[model samples]
Target: MTIAHILHRVADYDAWRKVYDSVGDMQKDGGVTQESVHRMVDDPDNLLVIHHFDTMESARAFFGRSDLRDAMERGGVQGEPRVELFE
Candidate 1:
């Protein structure tokens, strides 16, 4: 099964841009073999990250990495960003 991550941000574009720029390299690195990312039209601040991993284990392994989590936090992301995991 594929794992999907839905992220919603309530911050301004400048904050989002800053965080996005800081994490640019990390995001380029593939977490899973098969992944697709999308931005929702309903909410410009919302981003949908879809991953089609070889297995749920692989997906979890990637998502559970502390390095990436640290990077995200260090990126200085502000506002209340909601995250939802779906399978």
Candidate 2:
């Protein structure tokens, strides 16, 4: 099993969430099997997204996609996202 861990700050959680929810197909196409979202207690705008994949290669490929960047930008992401893969 592999997990793509994405951490980023968004300008507005509610607005970002709308865009995030709209990208369901992107996530499905990326080979994501499951997902979980978390928000920092002290900073509501800070978000952590965990996407479970069947393999590390899939996780890595998904994390490196330009479309993902575009999606994040469209979602009101405030800065560069921090991404990691765990297997």
Best by lDDT: 2
Query: What lDDT does model 1 reach?
Result: 0.55
> Which digits, one per residue and each the tens of the lDDT, describe model 1 over residues 1-87?
656564645345446556655654554463455555466787755565555555566566666667756655654434444544456
Task: Evaluate candidate 2 by giving its C-alpha RMSD to the native, one decimal.
Answer: 0.9
Q: After superposition, how far is residue 24 of candidate 1 from its true place, in Å?
A: 8.9
Worst 10 residues of 2 by lDDT: 78-87
Which pairs clash inside model 1?
A: none
Error of 1 at 76 (Å): 5.1
Residue 60 of candidate 2: its Cα lDDT?
84
In order, the Cα lDDT scores of the candidates are 0.55, 0.90
Candidate 2 has what TM-score? 0.94
Segments of candidate 1 deviating more than 4 angstroms: 10-31, 74-87
lDDT tens readout by residue for model 2, 18-64: 98899889999998999988999999999999999999988888888
Kindly report which residue pairs in candidate 2 clash with one another: none
